[model samples]
Each structure stands twice: as structure tokens, then as C-alpha cells.
Target: MSKNPDTATQSSSGVPPLNPADQKRRDAASTLGNASQSKSSPEGVKEGGELPKGWEWKTIPDLVTDDGVFIDGDWVESKDQDPNGDVRLIQLADVGDGVYRNRSDRFMTKAKAHALHCTLLKDGDVLIARMPDPLGRACIFPGDKRLSVTVVDVAIVRSGNGEFDHRWLACFVNAHPFRSAISGLQAGSTRKRISRGNLATIPLPVPPLPEQRRIVAEIEKQFTRLEAGVAALQRVQANLKRYRAAVLKAACEGRLVPTEAELPRRSGVPPLGSAKKRQDAASTFETGEALLARILTERRQNWLARRSHGEGGKARGQYKEPAAPDTTNLPTIPNGWTWANGEQLFSWSSGAGLTQQDIQEGNYPVYGGNGVTGYHNAFVAEIPTLIIGRVGALCGNVYLTDGPAWITDNAIYAIQTPSCVAMRFIRLAFTRAELNKRAAGSGQPFVNQRMLNETVIPLPPLAEQTRIVAEVERRLSVVEELESVVSANLQRATRLRNSILQKAFTGGLR
Candidate 1:
């Protein structure tokens, strides 16, 4: 604040200046001021007798006069404004403590401001906003050139006496309890708001003029120390996030371990390119239709041979739909590699389709294509295998588990077929696949079992598949850990911020 020429008089008792006192004396005085607040009657003894002896509780209206010209107007919400509208203006964003921010915010016309009879801002004036969240946030009007803006629903407070400084009032307005009370004032179902009427009724504590100055100085000192701590933690948070992203990116790129090196590369991409491929060089089963035909024919032959006395117990032709081509119908694979549908690779089953009656306890674990959903006594699949989420939670979010599961039919299961495909590789490939990419749906993205079974899988050598799986886990583990740590630190930062506010409000800053 600029030095006011008005402070010319001295104490009638000829009290000496505060040159001889140490900081401990000032702190002691503040402590006394704080302690006296809890008592009905306080002692008159001052710090060595020159400082003020008593403090008083007051409302905001008691300290600041509603003295400035009352100003209000409908905001002209437009990008274009007259550059010549010269009466200085102060808008909401300009309410930074002890000064106005220099950002180019909204502008208003001087004529409009005059028409509204809004309060004219001046140097050393205290401005408290009547908004939400930071509604009670107060700042001092700077003693400089006028701003080309209009005061919104902000309270401009002018000191009632020359003895009390408005800057000190602004600091108190920004204090903890003040903010907490403001938080309580907000009202709305979604968007919060604080009424201007309630803003004027908030409590205020005032001490003698010089004593107020001492309190402000002490508060600023304490805050500076606290901010240093917060800043240190902030750096730690940033470093953790960076470390996490780096680890995931590196792992996905096959750089986790040195021994598990790159697989031998070919010049051109594999020729089996229709976004799909089928089973390899076997005469047993070629096309899916051919295999189904053969299965049907064999069943018919066995059915005819078994039926001797015209009355057969069970139909020999009856059979499940060839288990949807576990391995035979899949396309030809490269050497040492075999092609297989995701379903046949494991003993698979969907979650129980309980009619709400099967949802009782003592049932089996209900599993969806994604994972466990509920419990039912009856089970379709029983194994810890891969669950490719078919429906909701689109684009293949896979979860691994060995438990009783209740799943939705929206997801599919992968059970054991043979030692052809590395299960881990399948899991990682499913993870790496942007299955959700270009995936469209009104609700959460999803896929069908057919879509999943039909998706192409590049079969590298089984050993290479194992290496890839190992590398992915090694890489993702670090990322997952880092993410967890960063998330925790962020929460901790929030708690620390709240703690500082709580302490500041409960008279800790002194």
C-alpha cells in the first residue's frame, strides 16, 4: 500500500517507535491476541505497554463503510467494445489480492457504469466477490491507472476509519474461516452461488490499526513457508508422472529386457492379408464349412450304424456345433506356429443367464465375457482363462482371474485348446489392439463374440510370443506402480492444501 500522508499525528503518551523489540516480542503479542479471543475479559497489559491491549469481534459492515458510489449494470456480453469508453473499470477477474491482474478481460462502457451508479474503485480499497467456490475471495484495489471494466457482484469496501488499513482487511477476508463460511453460503443444485446479502453479514475480527498490520505480516510469513513445502511435493508429482509414461511406452515397444531381443524380421508383411487368415496345411480340416460338413457326415454315419432295432436311446447324430472350430478351421500358420480361435484356446463358457431366480447365494460364480458378474450354483465355464469383454467396456479390456465368476454374456471366454498360442501373448495382443478404435456405439463401446473370434492375430513363433508377453508385463508393472503413486500423491496434495486452509482458519498462522 502507498504511504498515506494522513498519518501525521503521534500517540499522546509519547510512546517510542518499535525499534527495540525483537521478532519474538511481535510473535508473543500475536499469541496474546489469539489467546485473548477465547476469553470474555482480557488484560490491558500490552507487549511492554506500547502495543494495543484489547481486541474486538465485529461484522464486515462495522469495519468498512458502504461509502463508495453504488454501481451495477447489465454486462454487455460482446467481444467488440469502444476503445474510447474511458472511465476506469474493474471486473471480476481483476480481483487479485492487493492488486488487479493485467489480463485483457471483458470491458464495459463508462456511460453504462455511470447509468448503474456502481461503486467507483480506488487505491487501498478492499474487494470481495460474491460468487461461488472463491466467492468470498478478497483483494485490494491497486493505486494506479483506472481499469476499463465494470464491477460485477463484488463488494468494494472502504475503511471506516483512517486508523484501519483496507489492505489488512483484504488479507482477513482471504483468511481460512472467511473462505469456509463462504463455502457454506453457496446454493444451487448443480452450479453454486452466493447471495450478495449474505456476503455482508459474515463475521470480522478487528484489532487496533498497528496490530492489524502485525497480523498481516505474520500471516504472509507463515504462508511463504507452507508454499515452499507444497512446491517441493509438486515437483515430485510431476517426476512420477513422467517416469510412468516413459516406462509404459518403452515396454510396449519391446525394450523391457536385453536378452529377449527382437524376432527375426521379414522384408514384406505376411501375404495372408484380408484382415483375416485361416488354418494351415492340414488335410483333416480346411475351410470352416468343410470341417462342419465332415463333422455332420461322421455324425450321420455313426447315427445310422448305431441304430439297429429302430428304437435308439440317444440320437447319435446329436452333437454341439463342432465347438466352433477350435483349431482345424483356422488358417495355416508359419513353421512351429498354429492358428486357433480365441474360444478353443481355453475351456470357455459365458456367465450364467440367471432368470433372477438363479441369482441366489450358493450358486456358481457368474461370468460375463469380461469377468465375474454374480454368483450362481450352476456354471458354464470353470477355469482361470482370458475373458475378452465383448459388449460394454468395449475394445477388449481383458481381466485374468482364477475364481468363481459371474459374468455377463456380453463378454467371451478363452479356454485351453492346445500349446499352440501363448496365452500371455494373446492377453497382451488384446491389450495392444485398439479394439475400441473406430468402435462405435451409443453407450460404452463393445464387441460381439463373432467379431472377437473373427479378429486377426499375427502368429509369431510361440517362443517369440512368450518373450513378448514377458516384456509387456515387465514394462506395464512399473507403469502401473508409478500411476498408483502419482494418484496417491495428487490426493495427498489436495489434503495438504485443505490442511493448510484449516490451520489458517483456526488461528494457526499466528
Candidate 2:
């Protein structure tokens, strides 16, 4: 995007513009050097956000004492052939400090270099790309010896000095207003570009001598801290995401629970046990009946709660908890176990419906098909509950609640019988379970209370259920740690990357 202007002469070939007030300060600063400051102090802060009295404010051009401007070089295209040349080539990769540092994987020959004489590199020279998204990004030449490469889509700004600091000037070019103005001038199709001539037009806020060094230091220090924090947050987010996935994986694997109890040592599947064993276990288990009774009682209460408090929804169906013993559905039961539907373990209720007036910006999390969408004043389920999305994008998505919630009409609540099942266990099961898939519908899937209540799930003993939940949590912790370590490393790498940029930008290194 460099303007193809031939500037082998030492004239200000374009604008004849210069601010007189700035010219006066430049003249004044040249005479005083850096002696104007507070007594018995290293330096003083700018007065009322002002630079020290004698400190001059100048554009980039005035700082350089070179006879000719940066445009005093030829502009040419790069080589088309790969070379076995002895000099390292500098590309956009090397033009980072607004100068070339020779980062190309290959070098160019003296013949190739002379053929493509875009711009020549000199000590204290600045190079800025005038193309793509990195337009206006300038780098300073910390000249030693490096290979010269094809200068494709790049502009070089040079100075011969005992004059300006390369590090200080690079930072100034990268600072706010200058970079912004350059980017704003970019115009093209498919690829964006700003002419090198346009880059020369970029305005800069050049504070004199000691002040430039101070501002660069301050900006570097603040940016270093910010880069560190951004790195840490990214690491934490990665760790948390991995941890959550681990938790789910362990829950499904069933390793989280303690497997302290030994199973019966059997050779092959044992022949059918005596019927009397089943009868005895059934008769002795009061829990089987009591848990079921409580669920039915709660289901009735939930129905009443819905009728009283819920916004009048569709009169779909009113389903009671399933009757306790259905021997037809089960041929056998485990010791002290019973076969039952989900209806006997929870109270099902549809979420509330409210017009815009009834809704208020409030504290309660409102559950809908899209998860929590608003703070609601009124509520749906009053206990620890499981909510399933009943419509729209997140249909079949399930969420577990810790307490009372205000939910939208597109979800249904399943409040577990207080003593029967652990709420967390049920929520985990729902996450893995296929509930909506069983519901029959075409356009929008619907799990009416009847279908939901009657859904059958394997009912392990209550004590076993608690054990399973504990095991899931225990196993999840290890997976969580693994994820945390990966995340932390990612964060560290990010911080190091930014540190490289900061060091290079702030004169910490070449």
C-alpha cells in the first residue's frame, strides 16, 4: 500500500504545513536539553496534566535530525524466485518494532536485492506495513547485521541519529491516535491497505526527551499487568470447562461412589432364587412403601399449588403419581427393592405463565427453554427441583434448582419427594436420560405430565442412590484437577506471548 512516489531527493515533497506554537517549543527544548524539572527530585509529574514547561510537543518528523525524509529511497516489488542467497530476508514478520529484524526463513542475494530496491535498511530506520489488518504497526531497526529480504507491501521510515531514540519512537507510532488514524484511512476490496505516503501523514504526540521515556515505561508496566490478568482468566476458564466435562464423565462411569461392599462371588449367572426370598425382602422393607406414599402425597400438593399459583395454562392433563406395586411390569426385584415409575418419586408441575405486567425485573432466576432468561418476581416450584425444557431451541435440556424458582411456561418442574431421592442424583440422571425422546410429537416435542410421571426408571435402594452421588463427586475431582493443569499452562503461554510483545514494544530488548 506504499505510495509509488520517487523520493530520491531531500525535500518535504508534499505538505508545507507546520504549527508555529510547536515550532517554538522544539526550538526551546533543543537549547535547554532536559534540565528543566523540580528541585531535589528525579523528575516531576506533568503540571495539571501538562508536560513540564520547557518540554516540547512535536510530531515525529521534527525529532529526526537527518537531512532527508524517510521517503528518500526507491520503491520496488519483491523477487519471484526462491534463492540460495547468503543474506536473511525481512518480511512483515520482521517488521514488528516498526523496523526490520530479519525474520524470514530464507535470505536474498545481492543481485535479487538490487533488482527489488523497495527500501534500503539503515540503523535507526523504522518500517511499518501499509497493508492488511496490521497497517500502521511500526518497528524500529536495532541495526547490527541481518539479511535483507523482499520488501513486499512494506514502507520504511529511516533516520541517522545522535538524534531520536528508536525505542521511544516505535512506541509513539503504536500509541492510540496515530494507529487509529492510519487504520481509518485503509481502503480496498478483499485486502485492506494504506499508502506509505498516508502513513507519513499520521499525527503523533511526541513529548520531549525524559517525558517520552517515562510515558513509555508507564504504558509498558500497565499493559504488562493487564496482559497477565487476561492470561490468567483464559487459563481459569479453560480449567473450569474441562472440570465440568470431567465431572459429567465420572458421574456416567459410576466410579465416584465407594465400592466397599463385596458382591456375591458367583460362577456364571446363578439359577433363579427362591420366591420366598423376594416375599421376605418385600415384607421387611417399610422404606419402599413410605417413600412411595410421600411422593403421591407431594404430587397432590403440587397439583393444588399449580392450580392456585400458576397462570392458567393449557388444560392438558392432570396426572396422579402411579400406583405403587405393578407386578406385571417387573418379574423380579432386588433385595429390599421395589419396581416403580418416576411418578412415585417426584411431584410434577408445569411452569407459570405471566403477561408482561405480572413480570418485573427482580431476583429470582426464571427458567425457560433457553435456560435462565430473566429475574422473575413470581415462582414455579417451591422446592429443590428438576426442570426440563418443554419447547423451543433447548427442548429436552434439563436444569436442577436449589430452591424456589420462577420459570416460563415452556418448562416442567419435577420436585423430588424430600426423603426418597437426592436432588443432585436425579438431575445427573436426567442429564443422561432420554425423556423427551420418548414423548411423541411432530413439530415441537412435548412431555405432558402424564408421560413424565409414568416414565419408568431403575429404582436402586435409597442408601445406594446416596452412595452413587458421593462416588460421582469423588471421581469428578480428579478429572477437574487434570483440566485445571491444562488450563493453567495455556494461560501461562498466553502471558509469555504478551510479555514478548511488551518487552519488544517498551525497549526492554531488541
Clashes per model (N, Cα, C within 3 A)? 44, 14
The estimated TM-scores of all candidates read 0.49, 0.42
Residue-wise lDDT of candidate 1 within 407-450, one digit each (tens)? Answer: 55666665333334466666665555456663557687766555
Model 2, 347-368: lDDT tens digits are 5777878654677887678888
Cα lDDT for residue 32, candidate 2: 20
Please name the candidate that would achieve the greatest TM-score relative to the true structure.
1
After superposition, candidate 2 runs with Cα above 4 Å error: 1-52, 67-83, 95-106, 118-124, 141-145, 217-510
Provide the lowest-lDDT 10-residue window in model 2: 38-47
Q: lDDT value for candidate 2?
A: 0.55
User: For candidate 2, what is the TM-score?
Assistant: 0.42
